[model samples]
Target: MQSGKFKTFYLPLAAIAAIIAGLALSFAWAAGLLGHRTTTRTFLGDSLQHFEPGYRRAHGKGICFTGVFRSSGAAASLSKARFFSQQEFPVIGRFSIGAGDPHAADTSTTTVSMALLLTADDKSQWRMKLNNAPYFPTRNAEGFLAQRSAFEPDPATGQPDPVRVAAFFKEYPEARKAVEYKATASSPSSFAGAQYNVINAFVLLAADGKRQPVRWSMRPRTTLGSLSAGDRAKASRDFLFDDIKQRLAIAPLYWDLTLQLAEAGDPIDDPSQPWPEERKQVIAGTLAVTGVHDQAAGGCRDINFDPTLVPPGIELSNDPVLAARAGIYAHSYNARLREIGLGKATEAVGHGDSH
Candidate 1:
């Protein structure tokens, strides 16, 4: 009778322990601590191919700028953020090419980016990282990893296999849409000519507790222009940076901060899908880029420019890629900081020998 009671009790306890162990394993797998993990380090490694100790793993080529954002008070109805209160905020900005190598020729890559950190008088900050592309190429982080894997250069050919690339597009139709968009869109001749978009959606909370989903873009005041084939061939490796410096020297560059309000049917989670053109847009403010400087001159070098770093009235959306970016940026920032601390890297690096 005692033996039967022990068997019943012990069996249930064993089962319970097994269940707890299984749950732990499941959580570990989901967190990417087990199995085949796709981590931020993996992305950094893939982006650079060979690590450049002191530089960023991606967008390694860049110049800094000092600016001011003058709010129009138009977006005050949508958000209680202080920066939208018809006041001027000091801004530190960076313009970068989306190339892995710091010394990459400007003409070699069409992808460019602008990142800004705007600070209000009360010390509230709005950090934005924008891309020239209106929409992202992949819908989620997994799709991004797959896309990178597909395009990884083969050892023998020094280019990705056509079959693999074709297969990737077949599997992820959204990527093809982005490629098609780029193919048809005219290339910007100068950095000032490109419109930089914040592809991720964010929720703007007003004083009345009303929440509005929105995306924003920095629409250039400068007219869009294109470089001829001959011009591109003769362009220096730092042509884009050089052009921006020359332009700023003549006069300040300006961009209108346009906020797009999401309609009921808009997809807030999928950055690969753009909203309809009919959506309502509000000109929140104007950004004046007054000056440009090298990273060594100490303007925007230490700023991480994490998209999730917003003021109190702004909150992150459910977009997986946006969520993943925060962690990835934190990791990258911390890793680089550690490297800099250990003297394994230097903070003042990049911008075509300006260091």
Candidate 2:
């Protein structure tokens, strides 16, 4: 009788203990999966493994430009930020090839990117980081790191491993948005002709205390000259960089900063998930890029357009990827500074758990 009672009680207790132990082990294993680490250094190391550390940054790896953002009453109702409500704001912009290869050919660089730092008289600033793609590839830091890992240097050849990248794509369906966008995108004749998009959603705090979720795109005012494969193929190595310089010399380049309001049921947390094409859009202001300069010795050289440098009147949405980018940008900036013997100044601080 005692044996039977002990068996009934002890068996249940043993089963419970086993279940608890299994859960604990699983949690620990899950936490450490995919070379995930909590520190900025470790995460960035993984993120940039495919590229060598250089004075240039990971994304905007080429020319830098200085400009001015001419704001009007258009954005005054949306946010109380001085830069947006004021007449003019000094802008530091960078134009670059897709990757850290500063000398990467225009045709080889699948997408071009732009980064801007808009500063107001009050010194309160807002930064916008945009890419030519209509959508983002990976939505979060983990996925971002994982995708980069897929392109990590091959042991035998020291080049990108196609098979690994293919495997990663097979596992991640969301990454298709980036691939499709890049594949169909027509090469712009000049940086001024490129349409830069802000895929992540942000909350704009109105002067009247109303909050609205919005996504924005900076559309080039210039009629873009489409480049044929033959045209890009036959062009000089630095054609994209030189083309921008020539274009800027003629007249100020213009990009209308257009904001799209997100309706209810829209995906505010996932940058990979773009809102419906029919969403309401408002033209916030014009970004007049006045000049082009070398990235190494330009105003934008030291400026880290921390995507989350959200001004007082603006708040970032719950998009995990968007939230995590500020730290990554800081890390990249520190790396650039360190590479040029400028030395690392400070550590990055931002929201979201590091993966």
Candidate 3:
């Protein structure tokens, strides 16, 4: 009887262990650990799988940043880029925060944030991630990331400390200019009321094949636009989204997509500094949001548009961030792809199949 009982219990326990081991192996395989097949599995698993979930829970789609696609706004005239010659092209813009988790509300409370996306023709897309200040103190990504890491919340306590903020700039003196600029600024009624810009200069290719490296800015149209201290006091975490929704409901949000041309052989790598107005050209284009997209699908989905995805005629003019971002973003995107079930193996196959 004892021998029989042992056989029954041991057989079941062994079988269960075998199943668990197989699952672990499969998971690693899916995560790209074992071989090429595993790598492909990892890619699919990482890339688009979380898009739906993120959209549902976070109320955002994973596009350029944290903001959702909300709605694919109407494609109208070339009004935003007022100075450019008349030629129309279908384009899309995704507004989002520059954060790790795509679902984070784009509150002005953060140290760094942005509205990043690609142009329809892929001629002038950018990661327009900036802080509340007008200028960036660091000349490159390394310095910026270092400072951001230090200023961000402490992993242990999940609280951002004044000491960390102070130490970040103290260690990186280049940040002083930007920090000072932010400090002296008048406190706004709402952080969401502040305008965001692409601090780095980029190239905006015109219909005639001319490339103009430009800085893009989006500002509130009305004088009643200021977000006051009282307003900020009552501001919701998703103030930007709500404010945008309200604005789009009443009137289209107009943004003049201006181009700042770079001089022949001018430095384009370090985008921290701006070209003088006299030397730069302001080629304007219209960006009107007829409607806001679904917050979740627009912001938290698995879509990440990298700056390097520029089309022909619109080339990288030796921008450091552009080059750095290309590699970093490619690796990041690939990693995320691997995390999902649709791994890299299938992506290449699909790309080839399309051709």
Best by lDDT: 1
lDDT values, one for every candidate: 0.84, 0.76, 0.48
Error at 331, model 3, angstroms: 4.1
Q: Write the per-residue lDDT of candidate 1 for residues 1-355, one digit (tens) a residue.
A: 9999999999899999999999999987655455434655576556436356656667877888999999999999889999899489899999998787767888877788999999998899999999998899888877888888898898999999999999999888889988788766654589999999999999999989999999999999999678887887888878898899899999999999999999997999999999998899999999999999886564576789999899999999999889778766765666666665677764446222462
Residue 318 lDDT in model 3? Answer: 67
lDDT of 2 by residue, 97-117 (tens): 776654456777667888898
TM-score of 3: 0.57
Quote the positional error of residue 140 for candidate 1 in Å: 0.2
lDDT of 3 by residue, 196-262 (tens): 5656566655545555565555553443455566776677766665555666667555544544556
TM-score of model 2 (CA atoms): 0.79
Query: Residue 90 error for model 1, in Å?
Result: 0.2
lDDT of 2 at 335: 70
